[model samples]
Target: MIDAILPPAVVAAESFDDPPAELFPEEEAAISRAVDKRRKEFATARLCARRAMAALGVPAAPVLPGPRGAPQWPAGVVGSMTHCDGYRAAVLGRAEHVTSVGIDAEPDGPLPPGVLGEIALPEEQEHLRALAASRPGVHWDRMLFSAKESVYKTWFPLTGRWLGFEEAVVALDPAAGSFEARLLVPGPVVDGTKVTGFAGRWLAERGLVVTAIVLPSAGP
Candidate 1:
């Protein structure tokens, strides 16, 4: 996923085909009261995240949920995580070189009726129909939802503001296997510059739809 979407220097990713069943004490407390299913997902995501951190030479550490339920990474690390049926992944990059990151995965399935109306703009729905007409096989509605989620994950850490699904327009390029999020609200400042949009990559394969966004550090 990292190689398909990000520059080699910008990020590294780790994934789990089999989710671990154990959770560290701290990680357990992170979702101590949640249901069994929630706990498993929580623990598995951390396991993936820790491995990603270790691969970057960072010490083993607990990734606890922070404000807005975003995973809090150790100092000097910027990363993201996503988990879906049978798939979980984490991507990490050095804070000095990467500003923020967001990743998401979803089962390749149709969005519930009326879901597209809620999450998509008028133009997006039209384009989605075209995509479905041509591609026909991929679940473009669900892919759009996942892409919007990835955008929010990338945006919140940068601006600390809420961005609704309708607030960001996602345009997918099937030819390039990527997507771009056009921010409809005031954008974030990166490298001292206010950028209007973000670039992301998406892939649909192996019964999953995955999307990622990496904001490389605008160096100080």
Candidate 2:
């Protein structure tokens, strides 16, 4: 399902059930004190990540969290991972072909009361309201939140900076199953260029809402 949204250069792996709790020594150290549920999720997400790595012909390595809880990928690789109830996914691409990748998955449900207002700007809220009225089947609020997550995930690796929920103004296209985020603050510089915004794709299906943003490499 994730592969459908990503480009051909990216390799994606997903699983619906938790695999056996297994982790490298370094990975185990990262969550040594966590509860069983947290351990399981961490282990399974790494499992999916390694699967993507193998597809990219890279050796399996521990995907430890770097600053701000972002996965630390191997040199020459860019990737992201996300997990939710009954779903875990990882997507990876070589740095030569893809500059960066970000992915997130969430339960296809409404955000808890009062949470939407906090994450969404006024204009985004107005747009979501219009979407809900016209097409009430999908949870536009959650989709918007997921899109922002993808935007942040894509931004951090490039800038090593924090992106608040209100920092990026997102617009979702229901018909295209795509979204674009316009940055409020200064954007990241990539390949001698400043990135002002990011465009990504979203999917709402099989009880999950998934979003992804992939920035292609600028050739030398």
Candidate 3:
């Protein structure tokens, strides 16, 4: 039932385990059947997460459900998850003692012109301009969209607040296989959280874009 698959990384991963017809339980409900596609999307993400942890030699700990429907990792592990139209991904590391991590994947597509203005700050707009000039025909909109979602997944658990797109700035360096972000306002998710230089990569093959965020050990 799980036809879609994520690429093999050093991390632990699984195909859809929940029903193939739907990713999440039917009780969760979807606005439309198409949204149900995300069920498989989410399922694969968790599977990949488990695999990624195992690859790291981390034990097979339960993904405990947190108060706000977030996945809680085994003690000493820090990680994050995300799923889009066709793919899902997760990354794990030792908790406070190890490092914080986040991952995201998005389909390549056009970005509505209006969205670029709405979500991007002035500096971000400039950055996008350069991306566009360099990679004409590539959708900057989609890139920005995935970038912010990656940022949220990377920063939110630490601060626990929902983030807005404009609140942060992103700088991408395609040549180096990485990008950077600077979160301006904290909001509830990462209050006063100054992530001056967060880095990540975009894997174009296998129809997936991934990001990995690592924070210093915020623990004993």
Candidate 2 residues 1-220, lDDT tens each?
9998999989999999997856899999999999988888889999999999999999999999999999999999999999899999999999999998989999999999999989999999999999999989899999999999999999999989999999999999999999999999999789999999999999999999999999999975
Q: Report the number of the highest-TM-score candidate.
A: 2
TM-score of 2: 0.98
lDDT preference between candidates 1 and 2, better one: 2
Tens-digit per-residue lDDT, 126-215, candidate 3: 888888899765566577777777777766676667778877888777676566777678433222454554566554545455555555
lDDT of 1 by residue, 1-220 (tens): 5457766645454464555556668877778889977776777777777777878889978888888999888999989988887777788888988888888999999999988899999989998999999888899999999999999999988888888999989898888888888989889778889978889998888788888898889675
TM-score of 3: 0.72
TM-score against truth, every candidate: 0.94, 0.98, 0.72
| Model 2, C-alpha of 126: deviation from truth (Å) | 0.4
Q: What C-alpha lDDT values do all the predictions have? A: 0.84, 0.94, 0.60
Ranking by lDDT: 2, 1, 3
Those runs of model 3 whose alpha carbons end farther than 4 Å from true positions after fitting are 1-36, 59-61, 64-69, 186-197, 218-220
Name model 2 segments beyond 4 Å from true.
Answer: none
Q: Give the clash count for each candidate.
A: 0, 0, 14
